[model samples]
Target: MARRILQASFVRRAALSAGWLAGLHTLAGCAPTLPVVVAPINCPVSAEQLARRCQAPQAIANGATYGEVLQLHQLDRKALRDCAAHDRLLAEMIVQCQRTILDYNDRLVEINRRIADKP
Candidate 1:
């Protein structure tokens, strides 16, 4: 019957797929794995470096002209912005490093599982 033939074909295809997957797994297991060493993430500017990079403008002298005070305020705002930019950069670096560490831990778990399952 046609139904019987279809069932037989399906079974054959399933068996072939299973065998192919097993062969691929065997081949992957035979690959040479090298050691993976991850260096620690570095993300911090020293106090001196930070001070040198972002020093706010000194306060205007007493009885200063309006223009001088305005200029000083603008410089102070720019300095604050520069400091915030540095902090944001550092925060992004930390986030990326944390994600990488998490992924590395996950891969390590999978590797351990495969090692344990190996014959």
Candidate 2:
């Protein structure tokens, strides 16, 4: 009877450990994979210029009046339209920079929403 109890306990512990490991394996498989981003090479534009242009929209988004927002949108549209006529690589960079600015604006909107939600 003593030997049987010991063997049963060992079996139970083994099964528990196997279940735990299987759960971990399932979770590892479900984990999201990170995206890989590559930077452009041999570009004509300087990083400083890109950074400055990118920040332009964010500055407006941060503290612009309704009229300023309208003006900024017009300016952004004109700039992107002009960029579309340039070299393909430069146009792509301009579009990417515009996307970054829009994304920043989206985050700022979300932050404002959260702040307004707070008591």
TM-score of every model? 0.53, 0.31
Q: Write the per-residue lDDT of candidate 1 for residues 2-40, one digit (tens) a residue.
A: 999999999999999999999999999887664464455
- Decoy 2 TM-score against native: 0.31
Kindly give the stretch of ten consecutive residues in candidate 2 with the minimal lDDT sum.
Answer: 34-43
Candidate 1's TM-score reads 0.53
The alpha-carbon RMSD values of the candidates against the true structure, listed in the order shown, are 10.2, 19.0
Query: How far in Å is the alpha carbon of 85 misplaced in model 2?
Result: 12
- The sequence of per-residue lDDT tens digits that candidate 2 reaches over residues 1-119 is 99999999999999999999999999998765433332333434677645543223324667678998888888887777655554465678767877776776676677677657655
